[model samples]
Target: MEKRKFLVVVDPSHERHLALERMLDIVTQRRESIANFHLLVGFEGADKADPNAPSEVIRGKQWFDELMAPVDATGVDYTVEFFWTANWRKSITDAAERFECDTIMLCESSAEHKRGITDSKWDLVRQARCDVVIVDEGTEAPIKTILAAVNTQAKDAGHQALNDRILERGKFLAEYFNADYHVVNAYTDSENFPDRQKISRMSGLPREKIYRDMGKPEDVIAATAERIGADMVIIGISPRTGLSAKFASHTTEKVMEKITVDVVALN
Candidate 1:
């Protein structure tokens, strides 16, 4: 999805500004206009938090201001809200939905890792039903390459794929970081459902440059990610609704079980 209004959630920690800067840089390079922006700061509740948050909001307003100043040449309209949230992920998802944000950005924290223990950003991505763009500690180094892992088949009426979302995201990344893009779609023929694979590729990409993996999706993504030396693996996830919850394959979750590379998920 093209970024219009991005939601950035952070505390006033040392790591906060850098992550915000990195995400802003990515948004800038995309040339996608942002209509509204929310910068939510979360911390433990205390007397200090109650009052300090407001003072910090006024004092640190320039942190975002100065970051935007350098990119002012882009002329992208943006408005910021220095707000507070008790639950980081819930706060971000709610603000994004309320503001109709196109993407979400947040710095990785110790608490964030704890959330991921069950499933990190996937929980947010799945629940929000929107594209989530996260900035990790290493995100600022310049994302030089992206590995888009998909599952498709050769026998279907359609061809293979290199996702447009992945490509668009990758193109934005490539331009910003001077990186190259690689498309990877891996599938194994299941006798029970052969056509499902073909439909998977058509969701967001052009059907070409197909890559085959002969086993489960988890194995395929891991091996392919290793083979290509990917900086991040962008995959698709289907949210578990009323009854399909039993069968949904969370590529992000499965891939996370095996690899340490960064992951981005779209639904």
Candidate 2:
């Protein structure tokens, strides 16, 4: 298997390093598949502190070293960098592109403020070219079950491509962790319900493992995930523009609001 490069964004404000922990867990489980990890620790204060100052740089390095003690003990190859800019959302995507990372990992707290999703996080999700993993609070290693949310009713080429990507990534993760893989499709009413054989053929899972229900996408995904006791949910996010981007919320975001499990958003 080809190794994957990961860009992990670490927020300095949060006490819990959920992203780091999740990355470490992945590295531990699939060491050979990981090429290297780039750790980006953000300190959002360009006006207050001199980012280039020796004292500040030293402090940031010290904090990073302390936080990475466990990572170092694992003997995995990684590089650490600090960002002093307040525009961390752009910085994260920029770093990912610069490093040619396949995926970007962030903690749930970094995406939420006061129990609400932040615009900055949504911007990163929409702008990022690579996959994004939002590590939820209290997420542990060795994920037991992974639920892949798909829209089988999609007919457009773009939506079809996204469904294929979701299934492919979901299967990859399930194999990586040796976990149960399940696919879910939501319908508005009985007339639009997805076909079981089509879902099974698309997901390569038994019919019994495929979940189809009639409801809003978010509600069905949340309910199905809870019913199956999934540890992580993988969904696709299509980039929006203009009025839709401002007025509409992505289904992935709505699912994030409803579920406590980790989410992997594919573009």
Candidate 3:
């Protein structure tokens, strides 16, 4: 199998390099499966400034070099690049495309209570072409349990494909880390409760590992994740626009607010 490439977005303002730490942990554990990493340091509102002319850029490079000393000692093949753009979401997505990365790993920066419409982190989640892992800064390394939240009652082809994608990514991570894997499905009413057998077949997990409840998606997901002591939650997110985007919050965003674990969002 070909090695998987990762685009790790670094925040210069954050005192803790959580995203880079998470990526390093993954590389340490799964060195054989990982390809070279590309680190993108984001400098928002610096689009007009020349890359080499700014004193901030020079200071940022010095800080970045010191931060990368440990990475260099590990002998992991990696490269660092900086981006100065007002449109952070576009810069991240474009870099992902340019590098042909399989996944984008970044720290969660939105407010814990609610994510505003202007939150670029959530926008990055919606805009990125590859799988995006939003790592909570407080999350511990070496994930112990993974909860794959799925909407098994959806009959449409698009949702079905998304459900399958969620399971595939979740199961891959579970096996890779040798962690416990569980599936959670929430239903709105009796008529639409998820089929246990279908979920079992789709997830390839036993009956005992499946969690089914009748409630709102965010509530069920948050409660189940808390109950299971999940270290990470893998959920699917569909891009929204226009009125839908303005009036409502995505289930993924709501779940992020309610839970403290890391989230892997598949588009």
Which candidate leads in TM-score? 2
lDDT of each: 0.56, 0.82, 0.81
Residue-wise C-alpha lDDT for candidate 2, range 148-266, written one tens digit per residue: 99988878787889899999999988987888999999999887879889989888999999999999888999999999989999988853557665543566678777878788888
Worst 10 residues of 2 by lDDT: 51-60
Per-residue lDDT for 45 in model 2?
Answer: 50
Indicate whether candidate 1 or candidate 3 has the larger lDDT.
3
Q: What ordering of candidates by TM-score runs from best to worst? A: 2, 3, 1
Report the C-alpha displacement of residue 154, candidate 1, in angstroms: 13
lDDT winner, 2 or 3? 2
Measured against the true structure, the TM-scores of the candidates, in listed sequence, are 0.62, 0.90, 0.88
For residues 119-218, what per-residue lDDT tens digits would candidate 1 score against the true structure? 4345666676566654444443446667666544333322233244554555554454566555665555545333434533443334333346567777
lDDT of 1 at 73: 58
State each candidate's clash count.
Answer: 1, 0, 0
User: Candidate 1 or 2, higher TM-score?
Assistant: 2
